[model samples]
Every structure is written in structure tokens, then in C-alpha cells.
Target: MQRVRTAPRHIAFETRPAGKPLDAEWTQITTREFADQVSAFAKGLIASGVRAGDTVMIMAPTQYLWAVVDHAALFAGAVVVPVYDTASPAQLQAIIADARPVLAFTGTAVHGERLAQAATASGTEAPQLRLLDPDPAIPNDASLAGLAELGTTVTDAQLEERRLAATLDDVATIVYTSGTTGDPKGALITHRNLVGQVLNTAAAYSEVVQETGNTVLFLPLTHVLGRALQLICIANGMRVAHLSDPKEVVQSLAILRPTFLVVVPRVLEKIEDAAANSAREKKVLPLWRAAHRAAVAWGVHLEAMDRDPGARAPLGLRLRHALFDRVFYGKLRAVMGGRIDYLLSGAATLRPELARFFRGIGVPVIEGYGLTETTAPLTGGRPGSLVAGSVGTPLPGNAVRIADSGEVLAKGVGVFAGYRNPVHTEQAFVDGYFRTGDLGSLAPDGTLTLRGRLKHVIVTSTGRTVSPESWEQTVEQHPLVAHAALVGTDRPYLTALVVIDTEAATAWFRDRGDAPARALTEDGLVVCADGRLTEEISAAIHRANAAVSPSERVQAWEAVVIGEDRASEFVTPTMKLKRQALLDEAASITDGLYR
Candidate 1:
């Protein structure tokens, strides 16, 4: 925090209007200005009875204000607790009860009202609420602007004293998990964990973390991954633009021309799909297909060279790729603002195909592995030594090992102290290492290759265990698949419930001039008696099955239509499918597959 404050000449953050191009009139906050705002907010929080150890919850999306308040709370010697704005009222109430924050910040009035209602329902006094953007949608006790005014009288010495009084061992945050398993558990993160994360990330990425660059952060600050990036950007003195809404990311990308990006895999996939769709719309499908094939071939050749430096791409393919790069890859890169030099992806595995395509086109996606409990990254890919399928070696200062049960265990300064639940915390560690509950293996060079979540694995009646995630990754690669879940827990064989990517499927049918099967339904892609679409989907299924072992191959599958409501039921906010939740909701369809 102090380092950023001293770098007054540096633009700390750039806040752009929603839906506007990045160059459109945007507010730039210099490091000095950011520090002043944080100082004033810290004073406001302090004057409002916030003290060391008090929890201050920020229930909002990613934005400049959210970052300010988070820093201010820390400066005021208080613990920060962040809740996802998309969280249900019940989840909100549960977190409120657990953290018992003395003050809370909400991005919008709707969230303010929800928090108020949840507090009332929980029979606890609602925390003093401040709004990031106060509108008439709900009542707010005071606006962040108003709070900043209230804090104008605070002096720098007061803020410094508060900062000095706190130790690294002090609790800094209680980041609640997204609750894919059950109710969310608040993981206790201390000042040390935050510092360790920054230090280790810098060590792992070398200059990537230390060098200043232009970046756009769209990940929710509520998640540890997002929170870590926010802090890292500030600490590294990067010029950053914040996007609260993910939908605007693509448009903003072209305008921002960010040199570096931190993202989830879904965003990359969306970009790939959009690029393909754009090509088709422009009457250049043939060109796009040729470029894609060349990119894949180029990527393969590069990988081979990584293994054997003397290796080279066949001259014919190399020449074709170079020609296509000028025509296709250059245009695609412009969609990402054309300046992206590197990317860091986490939260889930990045598909190797997507990774290869981006790298082949010049923007390398460095996949990393970590969980909420690990404070963001335990393992990360290096700049030039990236292994497509592996999340490169553990970040410096972190040690990873696979347990006898195949669960990954991590011991590091970045690991969280424990969950808020005493018993849960007690069971989370073994021999001082945090049990990640993720199954993975370490390559000879120590790169981590994640397989699946232990709890999400399916065991068939024949005693064959399969990682649904591995199959799902391969299945979802098909353009028509919106989502897929493999099911067969204790059943005879594995089957899948697939959701169609409606727009893509519609385009597929329209392009083929086969319009009349049955309009895509809310129930999902309806199979025609013997239509080309059905045959294509079957072929996709066969391709996915071929990628896995016979025992793990999907035997039977059914496509289920998921309306907006059903979409939420099938996937977590983080985009991870809740296997049990989805299966229970689609019990009839799942059972029919076996019959």
C-alpha cells in the first residue's frame, strides 16, 4: 500500500464508463490520489467505530471503489470480508452472521437492500451500509462519496499509526468459498498470506509480476483470484482498468489493448467463439478454418521444438502459417486490442486447445493452479517454458505433493490459516500441509497436472473411477455443447447430460439449410429422428469418448434444455458444475439414459 502511495507519477487505476470504449473519457487515479482516497476512507471507517480485528465486509462487484474500500479497511486496521454480489440472500446472511461485520459496502442499492433484509432476517443488527453507487433502487445509509467527505479531516499520521500497529499475523480477510460443495466456508487469510502471495507470484513469474504493464481486470474482487490480482496490480504499479461486468470485457479489450491479462478460461473460449462467428459472418469461414488448422499445426511444432530445440515446422506448413498470421491472426489479436503480450488463467483448468491457439497466435496463456484456500496461485506457468497441459511448477516458497489417496497437498506461506469452522479447519490440514482435495500429479519437472476434484469423481458399479471433469473438458470443446455433466456414480456405466449452445446450434442448422427439426427448446437440443444436427452431435460425443479410457467413456447421453433458471441449477457461480445438484435436478433425464 505504501509503495503504491509513493509512486505518485504512476497511474494506478483507470475507471471507464460501462459499455464505453476504453479510450472514451475515463478517470485515471494516480498512485498518490489512490493513497489519499484510501487514507480518507480509512479515517472514515475508523471514526465510524471500525477497529483492529473488526470485520468490514465489501459485498460488491469489481470496481475502483471496491478496491479503495478494501485497502482503506486494511489501512484502518480491520479485517476485510468480501461477498460475491451475485450471492443469494441466504448466502449473504450466512456470511454476515459468520463475519459479523461492523460495516459493509455494497456496489448497488439492490445489494444494499438485500444485505439489510438478510441482516434483519438473521436477527442481527445490520452493519452500517455504504454504497459504491447509490441509486433509488434501495435505501443506503450513506454513499462512499459521502463517507469520503466525512473522512476529509483525517491526517496521514493517523492512517500510518493504524498501519504500523498491525502485524503480518493479523487477520486480513475471511474469503468465503463459492460453496460448490455445500454452504460457503470462510477461509481465514492473514496479512502474511497476502504478502506471501505477492512475493511468491513475483518470484514465479519473474519480471511478469514486477514489470509495469497495461492490464484490464474483469474478475470479481469477491474471489481470491480476483482479489489477489487487484492487490498485485497495485503493488506492481501496473496501469489497470477495472470492469465490473464481464459482458463488456471483449469490447473493452480491443480498446484497452492491454499488454497483460488475468482471466478465467471461459473468457478465452468466448473470445474464440466470437472470433469464429465473426469470420463466418464476414464470408471468410474458409479462411478462418484454414487459419485455425495452421495455428494448431504451428502450436504442435512449437511444442515439439520446446522438447527438442532442433525441431522445426515443415516448410510448407510454416509458410502457410506465416501467410495466415498476417491475414487471420493479426485481425483476431486486434479484437483483444492487439497489444496483449501474455495472459494468466486460473480458477479452473484451461483447455489445451484454447491455450495452443492463443500461443500460436502470439499471446501466450500461462495457466496456473490454486484454490481459495491457497490465496490464488500455488503453481504457475513460466513465460517461455509453458507446458500446454500443465500448470507449471509450484510458485517459489510453496511445496506441493500428491498424497496416497491422490489428493494434492500444499504447504506454503500463502496457504490460508484455516476455515472459520473449527472442526473444518482441524480436518483441512494433515502434517501441516493443507489438503487441497484436488487430485493431481507432479511431472518430473514439478509441473502440476490436475485431474479432478475428489468429491466430484464418479465411481461406476464395475469399480472403475472416472474424473467427470476430464471428460467434460473434452466434451465441451464441441461448439454445440453449452455444458456437459458425466453421471454414473455407482451406476453400471457413465452417461452424460448435455446442454446445447443455442446460438451456435442455431447457426449450425441455418448454415446447413436444414431448418425444420424442432426449434431449439428450453429443454435443450431436440434430437431429430435422423437429422444432420443429430448426427453431428453423435459424432461429437464419439470424439469426446475416444479421448478417454473405455471404462471412462460416456456410454449413453441425453441433451437437456436449460432455461435461464435451469442454467443456475446446473452450474456454480464460478462456472463449475455441481454434479450432485445437476444430477438430482435432471434425475429423470439421467435415469432415461440408462434405460
Candidate 2:
């Protein structure tokens, strides 16, 4: 808040006014103006009887207003509880029953109505509802603007006092897990936890602050990584743009031309696909493939030299890499607004091949690892000190170690306090370190390579224990596969449920002029009406199986194409497949495979 007051010209977010061309000049709000808005919103909460420690629910999409309300709630000395906008009614009811927030901010009319219905169904009074973006057409509900109007009644002195009253140990947020196994448990995050994230991120990636002029954040603010970046930007007084709709990302990137980005692997994969498709369309597939190979080679050489500064790239490879930079890499850079220096990837493990490809193109992607319980990232790759396959060293004051059982345990200032359910909280910690439940090994150099979730390990009937993550990683690398989940739990052999990348698969078929209009449905089968599509999937499975050990190989598999019927069949919002959910959904398919 003080930083905002100091840097008045620092652009916070770009606002595209209604009825204007997207390419038109964006309305810029400085830190000073944004601070005032936050202060006003904070005052409104206080005027509405919200007090210190009061739980305020922010159930909305990623937008500037979401950040405003989030900061406002915190400034009002309230503990925030973020609810995913896509959460089911029962999930909403469960959250409402648990936290019972004094106030709730909804993204749209549909979300507001869902909350009201969920509250009524749960037999609990609904929190004071305010629409983040109220439609004038439907003026029945309260608006965020109205809430801000209420804030004008409170004086600045009172607001300042309340903001200053918060301490480091105070509960800042209760972020719920994706709940793949069972009910979602709220992880208690503190002001100290958040502060640690900001300080550590800045220290680790200072180049992101110094050289990168601005950043664009599109990830859901409900997620800790998004929230962490928000705080990092504010702390460093850097310019930022908060993107609301994911569809507008490309346009916004072209318009804002941000220098840095925080994203998931899915975003990069889409960009890579778009670039590859463009090359194929232009009949320059061979040239593009050559350039890609050159880039990966250059990236590998650079990483080798980075590890051992005395090392150097071979003359032939270096010459080819330099040639491609001028011919191919330049065009790829233009796709990302032509100024992106770094792409920080998290939430899901990034494919090293993709990371190398991006780096080969001159846009370095640094991967990180963490969960909601550990705030954002306990360990992340540093900007200048790049590691291709590793989630870099632990943050400044954090410690990451592999247990005898191979689970990754972390002790850090960024670690969450506990779960909202006391018993779960008690179980979450073991010997002072937070049990991440993720399996990984830390190198002597402090780089970490994640294996897979402990609970998601598949134990075959033959007594072979396989971590499906490695196999899934290989399968997803196939151009046709959007998602892959391995299943064998106590079965004879490993089987998989694959989701076809409709666009990529369609293009692949059309390119070959074989059943160009072939389509896949949500039906649980690998063979589409066009057997060629099924053959393509089978070939991909063969590639994946060949990469793993004989015992860990995917022996039998089926494609479960996602559609309206199977809208969130197995994947979480972050695109991580839910092992248990996938198993339950594909029970019949797996049984048939065994028979």
C-alpha cells in the first residue's frame, strides 16, 4: 500500500473501456489511484460490520477487481477464503458451511445465484453478496461499486489504523485444495507466508524486477501463484496488467507487450502448437523442424556451459543456432509480443523438451514446484541461473529434503500454518516439515526433480510400483494427446485413459488428407469412426511405453475424448489429472481392457 503511494506513475492494470477497439489505447491506472480504490473498498467492508479475523469469500475470475477486493479484504484485517468460480453447488455449500464468510464477492449473476442456492440448500444464511461486475440489466443484487460508495463514509484515519493493525502471524487466507481424493481442506496461509513468498521471489529472480519492465498475469487469482505474483509486482513497484478472460490473452499480449509472464505449461504447449501449425500451413514444416532442433541444441549447450562455465558449444551447432536465431527464432519471439524475456511456469510439471524448445527460441521458461499448502513455490529456477529439467534451488530461508520413503518435505517461512480441520492440520506436518505428499529428489546443487504424488502411485498385480507421472509426461508430449492418466492400482498391467487434443489431432488427420473431417466424442473408446485416429493414439502410447521400463510401461490403453458430456472428466483446473477421478470415470473401460 505504501509502495503504491510512492510510485504514482507505475501502471497497475490496463483497462479496456466498453465499446472500444481492443487495439485502442488502454486506460492506465497508476499505483496511487489503485491504492485509493483498495482503501475505499477496505473502508466499505469495515462499514459493513466486517472486522479483524472475519472471513471474506472472494469467488470470482482473474481480474483487476478481484485483486482490489482481495487486498481490500486483507487491509480491512479480514481473513480471505477463495472459492473457485467453477466449483459445484455442493462444493460451494461445503465451503459456505465451513467458513461462513461475512461477505462474498461473485463474478457474475450465475455465480451469485449459485451461491444463494447453495447457502439455502446447506441451511445456512448466505453471506452479503456483491457482484464484481454488476449488469445494469439485472439490478436486483448489490454491486461492487455500491460497496465502494459505502466506503466513502469511513475516514482515511480509521482505514489506516485498521490496515496497520495486522501482524505477521495473522491468518491471511484459507486456500482450499483441488480435492482430488475427497473433500477440500482449507490451508491456512499467514501474512508471514505471503511476505516470505514476495521477498524470496524478488531475491531469487531480481532480473524479473530490474530488466523486465512490465508483466501480464492471467492465472486465476484464487491460486496462490497468481496471488504471489500480485504481491511481488506491488512490492517491486513494477507495471502489471491483470487479464480477466483467458480468450483475450493473445490480443492483450499484443497490446500490452509485457516483458515477463507467469504461466502454466498448457499455455506454452498451445503457443508451440499454433506456431507448428502455422509452419505446416506455409509448407515450411521441414524448415521449422530444423530450426526447432537447432534451438533445442543451442539451449542444451547453453545449459551445459551454465553448469560448467568453462564448457562451450561445438562450432557446427553454434553456427547453426546463430543462423536459426535470425531465420526462425525471431518469428517465434514476435508471437509473444516480441519482448518476453522470461516465462515462469508452475502448477504442473513442465516437459523438459518444451522448456528446451522455448529456451532454444530465446524465451527462457523457468519451472517451479509447490502446492497450495506451501503458498506458491518453495523452490523455483532463477532467471540467470537456468536449469532445464529441475525446479531450481529452494527459496532463501527454505529447506527441501527427500524422505526415506521418497516424499518431498519442506520447511520454510512460506509454509502454510495448517488445515482448517484441526485433525488434518495435525497430520499435514511431520517432524516440523510440511509433508508435501509429492515425491522428489534434491540434487547436491539444490535443484529438485519431482517424481509423482505418493497417493497416485500405481501398484500392479505383479507387485511393480510405478509412478504414472513420468509416463503421462511422455504421453502428453505426443502432439495428439491433450491429457493422459495411467491406471493399474491393483490390476495386472498398466492402462491409460487419453484425451485427444482435438485441434492438433484434427490438423494431423487433415494434413494427411485421410478422413479430414474425422471427429472424436466423449465416448470411452480409443477407436473413433475413423480408425486412423485410433491408430494415431495407439502409436503415441507405443512411444510412451518404449520410454519407460518394461514393468512401468502402459500395456493397454483407451482414449476418453473430452466433450460436453465429460467436461472435467479427470483434470483439475491447473490441468493436473486427478488419478482417483480418472479411475472412477474409466472403471468400465479398464475392466473391459482386463477381460
Assess each prediction's global lDDT (C-alpha) against the native: 0.82, 0.82
Model 2 stretches astray by more than 4 angstroms: 18-21, 134-141, 506-530
lDDT of 2 at 257: 88
State the lDDT of candidate 2 residue by residue for 322-362, as single tens digits. 88888778877886789988898999889888899999888
Model 1 Cα lDDT, one tens digit per residue, 1-595: 6665467778888887655665698887898888888888898887777888899999888888888899999999999999988787788889888889899998877887899999988887899989888444443237766676676677778778987788888789999988777788999999999999987686666557553677888888888988898787788787788887778888888877788899888778878887788888889999898888888778777777777889978889989989998998988888888888889988888888788888888888899988899998888888768878788888878899999999999999889999999999999999999999999998888889998889988888999878888778877877777778888988999988877666677777777787734536545323333355556778778888898888888878877555553455556656666667667777877788888
Name the top TM-score candidate: 2
Candidate 2 TM-score over all chains jointly: 0.95
Candidate 1 TM-score versus the reference? 0.93
